[model samples]
Target: MEPTSDFDPARLARSLLRRSRQGALATLMPGTGDPYCSLVNLASHPDGSPILLISRLALHTKNILADGRVSLMLDERAEGDPLEGARVMLAGRAEEVTEAERELVRRRYLGAQPSAEVFVDFKDFSFFVIRPSGAHLVAGFGRIVDLKPGQFLTDLGGATPLLEAEAGAVAHMNEDHREAMNLYATRLLGADGADWICTGCDPDGMDMQAGRNALRLDFPERVTDGTGLRKMLVRLAGEARAKG
Candidate 1:
């Protein structure tokens, strides 16, 4: 079915992928080919793909090793009826992170799941990225649609500088700009005030959290470098403060 011009399935799907802290990860059991599902913590890659860190000894991890194909379910976790909230089921291959990409992946994961730092380096644990093949988003009666990767995933083509500078920028915000973070949440994003911190930033948006509650702040325009990020943030801060 065609989505109305006003409803954006891609944007909704991206928000779910970015904001969800945990998801129902489904993998195929080796011999029986049965579907095995487990609750797994998650984070987003700079390009908006889901990231998972799991123990090699775990059944779901073992299933992934046998068959890389998997499906992940993420939702808004809204109040009241769960079915009334938006959700997306993403189909993809969950491939282990290559050595070259480990550090970047690790930083992004830990940013979202800070407690995982305790055992992130354990021999049994490894990182995997779900390179999405497609997604099925169920928003409501007329909002159901299948989105191709291009429709939902952020294009990182010219965003290398932002990706490279993400860790430093995130640290800088958390360390030196707590007030601004609070403003972004309370004023810009309309989130309740708290000690919100920047988890990660990509070309498309910034991710933030205060305890378990998460928020996504989309950039007014894409940023690809440290300077662009700085200016865009300053602009956002101004806009947020103006709301006062």
Candidate 2:
């Protein structure tokens, strides 16, 4: 495999925060004085904080309001090979979102899970934002990466160069360089020519139409325009040639 970039804790955390599906939420049971754990679907805010859309009447939701202390574990369930994946657990305080924040939370949550539209109408269902006090990241069996509380939960403000570069890379690759895609697929990804097709592009990344799934690549280098993108392609092509 090509040399992977130095493992970026923030980037890795952001990636996991963006992609994972289910999370285990541990909440306090009101009068019982015990902790209640429930499997809930969750999403991350743009800055990588965890949030949950839950029913106010649900056991966990009620438990949270009664006592805001809670912990959320967002991780990929081990399947097949255990050594290749990672997981993150976050401990935090949960609170019902204020009216001003509800709309933004709803948009992000609904965008990821359109199916929730069916049950979102329930009067009991509401949005809860979790502000993590600490986090733990595990990359594989026996490989521990611990982080301080609130490490990945900060607001960094408006878009930065990384985001713009990633977007420009995607747009240029998808719109102007279709032929180069198949070459990269075979030369870089080591795929058969038939397995590669350019599907779509945006400012963030390029989507490859591979079989049943789409593969997205977020370019790490700056690519602001067609000229800059061409230079990137040339560099990639030179790398392929060097490997051959």
Candidate 3:
């Protein structure tokens, strides 16, 4: 069947943004406009814009202050030629998040990296949001797409309740629902074996890890709460059982 209207390059680009925990950030230097690169941890706003916690004293923060235009590259690690794996380059403008959105952004950012709380309270620390203008995703050889942000990104406003509960859900599934997660990976995701453990879940998908291998599985439909999440898992389990 032909790809649906909703299925486009942006969807895959957004998938990269959803799965990546860390990415390379490049900013223009103050004096010469030279590109300065740094590693940054990533989180997302409800609109799928990138959110970063950076100290004002950091050079990259200075770059954002001087010039907002920036680019971020996120890629998956794979065996064999690294170029064979999927990766995305996102270009945008970065600016400090406003007061009204500060707390929620901070909460989401810190949820993924609780250790960041130690420095998050520091005087120089602040949150910045990167609203992408354009993106390019290379899904291995023979697949490439140029994406506009509007088409690819997910507006997760409906999933606020789910985002808030994600950390607890991760812990619970890894601890109590290992079998279900394993089935989700093997049966639904076509991943190898039952050793995968659930790491996190968002409205669109769930992430799992088997040692260094991270896998993301999209729901048959979007889910945005514990109830929906449970329903999806149960349905997936039933499907897996039926295949037995």
Candidate 4:
């Protein structure tokens, strides 16, 4: 799909907010004046800013309390061509959340990392919130969208033309095309009969169930007509056969 002149920061934020489970957090080590990094599971607040829960004793957590400056890099990790996926980096200031706000942060964090139940009991682990300074949103290969913290958070509720149309296109393809679906699954996705399911399709693309997750295909153009849809299916099949 061609890039839009106005990028939807909110849509991008929500996508990052929904799909990211792990991020690389970079924190400044106090005495040494160096940066330390660790992988952390994060969740976003309703306003779309990240809320980080950390064990007080964890090295990164300790560094944050001392210096407050932090950077987080989140990316989609599903198996695929890495160039096709999205990733974002958030620069923020971390602070130990206030006692009154702790419950909300705790709930959101635990919702994403249910297994944190085991470690939540540990006295050293607690919620630390990040108030972002800025964000860098990257969609697929070279599409980079940068925003100030306020703009990024505010845009989360705004609509994007492509995403809106893409949803509808995905619905149409999945509902109407079963033969092309099977061929794509068998040929491109390399999945056996029992493994495929038509998940959804929209003007911009289709999603098919492959193994335990769904594989997404973007349309060449805003595809509402049957001919455009057929061409998409054929393209997918050709790509699958070529790759195989």
What lDDT would each prediction earn against the true structure?
A: 0.94, 0.63, 0.79, 0.64
- Using TM-score as the measure, the top candidate is 1
TM-score of each: 0.98, 0.63, 0.77, 0.59
Candidate 4 overall Cα lDDT vs. reference?
0.64
Model 4 alpha-carbon miss at residue 26, Å:
0.5
Q: Give residue 65's lDDT in candidate 2 (0 to 100).
A: 78
lDDT of 3: 0.79
The residue ranges of model 2 lying beyond 4 angstroms of the native Cα positions read 1-7, 81-84, 158-244
If both were scored by TM-score, which would come out higher, candidate 2 or candidate 3? 3
RMSD of each: 0.8, 7.0, 4.0, 10.2
Clashes of 2: 5
lDDT ranking of the models? 1, 3, 4, 2
Segments in model 3 whose C-alpha atoms lie over 4 Å from true places: 1-8, 114-118, 140-142, 157-176, 192-200, 209-213, 224-226, 241-244
lDDT of candidate 4 over 192-239, digit per residue (tens): 755454443335445455443334444456555555555766777677
Whichever of 1 and 3 has more lDDT, that candidate is: 1
Tell how far residue 190 is off in model 2, in angstroms. 10
Clashing pairs in 2: 56-124, 133-149, 134-149, 167-203, 167-204
Off by over 4 Å in 4: 1-3, 154-244
lDDT of 3 by residue, 1-244 (tens): 2334544566677667766778899999999999999999877665667789998989999999999999999888668887888888999999898998887788667655566888988989999999999988887545677778877676576887887776677778878988888787788778788577765677777766675456667778999888888888888889986765
